[model samples]
Target: MSTQYTYTAFLYWLLLAGLIVFFLFLSWDLQLFQTIFVQDITRISSLIFILFIAVSVHCGYRSWFVASQSLMLLKIKKLSLDDLKLLSDDAFESRSVIKDFLSKVLNSHSEPDKTLATEVLAESLRGAHQVGWFMAGVVIKLGLLGTVVGFVLMLSSISAFEQLDISDIKELMQQMTLGMGVAMNTTMVGLIASMTLGIQLLLVDRCADRLLLETIDFSLSTVDLVVDNRGEGGAPLSAQK
Candidate 1:
């Protein structure tokens, strides 16, 4: 009956849903994928783009998992300082950033400890966002690379048209049309892939932001509870300074 177990199950279902959608698309028209890949001016780049998308999806899944875990922790109502301490210990043992952060704050009675914990938390947040953004940029750049390759193919056919006789005009036009098709097809595929992947990355970012805010709230609450507990024992928090 743990929320973490339920959340994990939900993520598994989401992954299943994605797989079903992919299979459905494949069944509807298998040739669409073939056309996109087979006819691409730079098939290698197209393959690389697909690889990047897979990587992005994986990164997004990881971000979602962390966000869900944090949200579950935050939903605990009427949590006491002891409960917070227990959660921190559990988190540290489980290798969770939020739990680790709480553990740090609980152990940190001095300014230096607090500063170090803050730095560690910031680094964790930065790393989560950095991979998503970096992959998004790489996907977009691959699309642009495909666009350039397409244009080059189209332009290269232009010289053949000039050397052809009048009777060969039809053949010349056909060649040029083929080149243009290659150019357009690759460009279209690249752009669409880039846009879709970028949107997914954006979603991951939004989830990360939510996770971060929740952690900040928890951290502040933990600090206040620790200070209050110390005060009740006739020791002011300032004494640590």
Candidate 2:
């Protein structure tokens, strides 16, 4: 399972890298970077937007990987206590919620203790989804920030036209137009980044939900197995025999 996760993560990153490179190539071919990044306003916003996109993509991949692992676990129709113990061992050797929960269960002697551990594990799983959501909000806020900055710059450019000289009007108008362009470019970049990241985050949220459900079900099964092994009087079956 650890190997599978590692392979999945590797493949996801590789695909992401390829897509980023392809996007860069396409932007270069379209001369978008040259035109949009010509000014400080657009350039800075674009850089921030790109950074957020990368973070969002990485977060999405992590969520997907975790969810995929949980889904795989759900496929097993039957899992005995020994099978679960082995799985728990593997999980402990790696970084996984299943391992943490299983470890807690193995150490816990009562149903209430196991239930508490399960709750803790669920919280841990939720942390990942929360991060994706927070980042998605940040991406949108950055875009809005760029929009405000662009408009401020555009308004400031109006000072150049105060003289109202006919001969200089053309140049002033050109400057004003440039400022508007900066404003629009930043706005566009921000919106595009926000929307793209929003979609990714949405998917992450869905996967997280499914993963949580499966984890809960698995924990319940583990609890039942432990209870059953203890026999009717809460004593080990082997002791009764």
Q: Could you say which candidate leads in lDDT?
A: 2
Every candidate's lDDT: 0.60, 0.62
* True-structure lDDT of candidate 1: 0.60
What is candidate 1's lDDT per residue for 86-190, written digit by digit as tens?
655554335666666667777777878877876777677556656666666666666667676766766776765666678887876766666666666656655
Q: Please identify model 1 stretches exceeding 4 Å from their true place.
A: 1-30, 71-79, 83-93, 230-241
**Residue pairs that clash (backbone atoms under 3 angstroms), model 2:** none
TM-score of candidate 2 to 2 decimals = 0.73
**Model 1 alpha-carbon miss at residue 22, Å:** 5.2
Candidate 2 per-residue C-alpha lDDT over 1-241 given as tens digits, one digit per residue, 9 for 90 to 100? 2435424433554565577568868988999877888864456566755766677667656666665556445433234444545554554235666666766776678889888887877676666656766666776677677667777777777775667778887877777777777777777776776666665555555555666675666556556657667434443322332
Give the Å error, residue 95, model 2.
4.2
